[model samples]
Target: MKQSSAKQYAFSDAEYEELRRIIEQSVGIALASGKRDLVYGRVSRRVRALGLSSFAEYLARLRKGDQAELEELVNAMTTNVTQFFRESHHFDYLRETFLPEMVQRHQRDRVIRIWSAGCSSGEEPYSIAVVMAEFLDAHPGWRAEIWATDVDGAILRQAEEGVYPMESLKDVSQERLRRFFLRGKGVNEGKVRVGKSLREIVQFQRVNLIQPWRIRQSFDAVFCRNVIIYFDRAHKKQVVEGFADHLAPKGHLFLGHSESLHGLTDRYQLIGKTIYRRRD
Candidate 1:
């Protein structure tokens, strides 16, 4: 399928600077001095939707707390690209280490709780479901639930549907692909859908990581992966600390390989590379 592009905005240096300041202040996403093109690309659809011709006018309206335009602006700027099993090693670690630890921790209750913060689509959470299901089959009498969330409402809606093109499974193993996915027929022949059983294991919700958040209880594991790299250092620190606070003692925190908690927070003890467990 062809990707869609938003309407382009014609922005000047001053306009770019204004946008950079506003976004950085509101969400802590710092657009560098030379990022005029990126600012234009990201904000153009808001410009077109509001019938504003200049970036200054649109930006001023946004500063006035125009909720409608601000929502669109957030949509444009938030990165939503994701697919199933994008980072396979994380799943491997979950299966080999984290799940085993969780199983032992929850032996009396036999319930494992995992939170996939900023789960772009349904892929990551569903992948977790697949892993948990396989693990449960071996253990007998263990259960797991995955809470997946994203800031974008549209993406959360798509995630709840649990449908995607079959090609999204390219990296997934054939056994998992066959076991968890239902091959679409008729008009949906080229696509696949996650079955209800797997979908039921994962609950999708819309959540803004930057805002105050409360979970039912501390999670056994939190997957706030790749999404944090987009935030500035301050936002990164705040989010990581929040995750650490919500993490159970000895719970695990997984980050993208390129991401590091070094100097950001010291609450988590480094385990394997890119994986950190909350210091008990």
Candidate 2:
């Protein structure tokens, strides 16, 4: 349906409140007031696809506790906007400062682990992989691994496939593009695929930030950029504290340009713009 026709979707105030509660309980996104139209727009297709007549009926079915429907609901509401080397300074810091220090510290172990939480359709992790690949080319002995994860299964699948429209690589340099991606031709024209070397270094998985994480490894850096903005203050603090728990001592946490840890936690210190280091 057209956005202007969103009012025809039959969403009521009561139904909207129930959905807000469901989304917060299931996905940790706190949709504030004035987002009623947005919520209706995102879920209206699902309601129609399921052959439901109204938002009330959809909520009724969702109340039956169907896990699949719950997941679909979360997926519908989740936002996955992302791009390569976004907030370029983060990648620059990774290459110029963080990686060099990590290389020296892990000289004996020769392993570096990074987590790109809420990695969206894969740009962030892929960008990290490209930077790491370049670093590895020079060092020749170090190994790096990136855990790229998101709560949306559909987006996670896309992230794993590692394909993108050619236009998305606009910010990527020509040299780096040639080095890290295979240009598509013929049937796959106007597309690009991450090279084997870059793809091999990153692993994508489905993860919900509000829940207990099963990961056993500590990371040298955690990139949770532009993610926590969807969460409320309490949930945001929970997620940030969780990131700290999974970070190795002095490990860096990169947030979106507008995000900060100030007044949220004492576990990290601001080391740069939107960058925090675990306090020793």
Candidate 3:
């Protein structure tokens, strides 16, 4: 414990508060007081990487408006935990409930659009693509498109590449394994690349949720699960309200199981576990 606490640079309370405020203002991520060590460790890496001698010097650089450093700080501090199907039920709903309703609603025009906000490394969107492929197979001639977006440009590149450890697909069935992935060999063993068909349907882009969105088209569904919990109440409401504004009439919205729309917005009505629909 002593060695752990014996950080190389001195971390002061004032520095911590300043960082917390800067993070919240920049990305809308609310860094709680308990996350001091997390911030210190991540920020310290930046200081060292830049060859700065102290935390004060790093803070001085940040205050002087180093936009590139700011991006690096946020990227280092942000968490990007994901899996092929972290919440199995949401995908189940997409397959069993949402698509059927959408199919009937758009019988005349069969173009389906989906948005996977904060899609870290592309798992959620790839999972959605699998469901979409199956759906289109069942109902022929239907076209679907998905937009996978995240704030971290680094992770966005990973998502665009469509690679993952073979273990990441444990929840996936053998049939899906054959249909949606190409196994790596020799030097690349133990890794898998997402199939060409799945990659074709998704368009990945860098998007910061706190900032204004450039997308003008509405989506049939929005999967933003577990992302907004990092933001404060006001920012949470703002983002949710933005989702409501952009959703199609009675469009489905899927959030993380731990997240809720309660007291945040009244534009949505609960339809399933952590699922909601925008009110007309």
Which residue pairs clash within candidate 3? Answer: none
Q: Cα deviation in Å at residue 252, candidate 1?
A: 0.4
Model 3 Cα lDDT, one tens digit per residue, 1-280 = 1223578988888888899998988889998888988888888899999999888899999999999999898888878999998899998899998999999888877889999999988999999999999988989879999999988888989999999999989999999999889999999999999999999999999888999999889999999999998899999999999999889998989999889999988999999999999999
lDDT of residue 40 for candidate 2:
82
What does the lDDT read for residue 37 in candidate 3?
85
Q: Model 3, which residues run further than 4 Å from truth? A: 1-5
Alpha-carbon error at 126 in model 3, in Å?
A: 0.4
Can you list the residue pairs that collide in candidate 1? none
Q: Candidate 1 — worst ten consecutive residues by lDDT sum?
A: 1-10
Question: Each candidate: what lDDT?
Answer: 0.82, 0.91, 0.91
lDDT of 1 by residue, 212-248 (tens): 8866588888998888888889899999999988888
Give residue 260's error in model 1 in angstroms. 0.4
Measured by TM-score, how close is model 2 to the native structure?
0.96
Clashing pairs in 2: none
lDDT by residue for model 2 (1-280), tens = 2123436566667888889999998879999978987888889889989988888789889888888988998889999899999999999999999999998788788999999999989999999998888888889878999999999999989988999999999999999888889999999999999999988999998999998899898999999999998899999999999999999989999999889887999999998999999997
Error (Å) of candidate 2 at residue 68 is 0.9
Report the error of model 3 at residue 4, Å: 10
